[model samples]
Target: MLLDTPVRLGIQIRPQHVSYEDIRRAVLTLEDLGVDILFNWDHFYPLSGDPEGRHFESWTMLAAWAEQTEKVEFGALVNCNSYRNADLQADMARTVDHISAKGGEGRFIFGTGSGWFERDYDEYGYEFGTPGTRLTALAEALPRIEARWEKLVPVPTRKIPVLIGGKGEQKTLRIVARHADIWHSFVTPEELAHKVSVIDEWAAKDGTDVSNLVVSNELQRRTTEDADALYDAGVRLFTLGFDGPDWDFDVVRRWLQWRDGKN
Candidate 1:
């Protein structure tokens, strides 16, 4: 479990039932408000609201955010590994990294996961493989993604930080132990402690030390006391989710105040 990392707050502005202009304004406001990381999700349809309501694609908006914000680190909460080829995903990440970098190493965090939403697959003409199949694909794809990062004409400006989101002990935690710089999940503080121990076991098996791997968890429904418990459990990165039509940031401001106190 991480010990010395600073408290950082991230916001995932779900891109559904809202206009692009509204999202752009929200982005600008979030950066100005000192949000540490800004995230969207990888999905074709609204995760909430009207199922067929208006929604934007993830990567294209992320590209725009790369140019729009200067201070905030940003990426998908978790891009679906099953949506695109591994090499292509790497190239896209490298390109965004270049775009987001302002005379320094870029702020793009390559947060990804094996795809899970079946509707996205069914409508997009991609196979809706079983969880095991998708996890297997993710395990295979990460190496190719890393390889492509090295082979690109203008390689990534920095060793891009990979954030893998999941809590599966058998497959997902093992993958996180092997490849991730950050591991994100929705588990509680107690669960986090147990999961981190499991991840450490996996790290030992992999012959790598993941001591520095940042533990990330959701803060949308949590109180400051709960967040403190998470902090005590070595969770340094806390993310709040904001839904669209009317994106609320009052909670974000409160979390920022909590983070400042912790730091």
Candidate 2:
């Protein structure tokens, strides 16, 4: 049996081709629908449809979500580690954590990864290094981020959960095994099972136990049967992406119902 954790549903609100007001309304709607987590990706331009569509920055929107939402944990689905300095990223995460506290502990998940989109780097004047170099930079930055969190005044409301995304067996999975509280990836059930085993091996090598690490996967274009297979493969966190203009929640509702049944 997978981890004995309750099934959790997350929705990634792709901040592309949408207005801020459209996003705001959808956030309230999704929370009311009982999503466990809400996420936005770190990107400068739209990944789908019009490349130059209406896009918003990730962290700024996260800060807004921190203030606007009451219960659902939120962050960038995967913050690009190359975009900002490690110390600054830590401070931003800590501040957002406090902002979302609402008289209780924070509901911020520090989801991050080595960035891949070259356009974002080129247009923004940031270095678009090779994948190896980027992953190495990510490895170097994560510890600095953790250290900065410890040094922050009035530290995070809680030990903010770290969710790392990527499935590279060499660098990414090792990073996840060493530092992640949650691991997000897009893969088939078979691939996920193998990756989970790989993570366990890495964790053992690193002297860390990932038994408590949550396994997350995407839900877009996936069936309930697919979700069941993913669950069988040890995934507990399922996330669906909703893009804008018209952020429909019908698919989300069906998935949430499935989640409720699983829980």
* Error in Å for residue 22 of model 1: 0.8
List TM-score per model, in order.
Answer: 0.98, 0.98
How far residue 30's Cα lies from its native spot in candidate 2, in Å, is 0.7
Reference-based lDDT, each prediction:
0.93, 0.93
Error of 2 at 87 (Å): 0.5
lDDT of 1 by residue, 1-263 (tens): 66798999999999999999989999999999999999999999998769999999999999999999998999999899999999999999999999999899999999999988999999999998799999999999999999999999899999999999999999999999999999999998888878998899999999978988999999877888999998988899999898865777787788889999999
Give per-residue lDDT, candidate 1, residue 163. 98
Off by over 4 Å in 2: none
Worst-scoring 10-residue span by lDDT in model 2: 243-252
Model 2 over residues 60-151: C-alpha lDDT tens digits? 99999999999999999899999999999999999999999999999999999999999999999999989999999999999999999999
Model 2 RMSD vs true structure: 1.1
Error of 1 at 155 (Å): 0.9
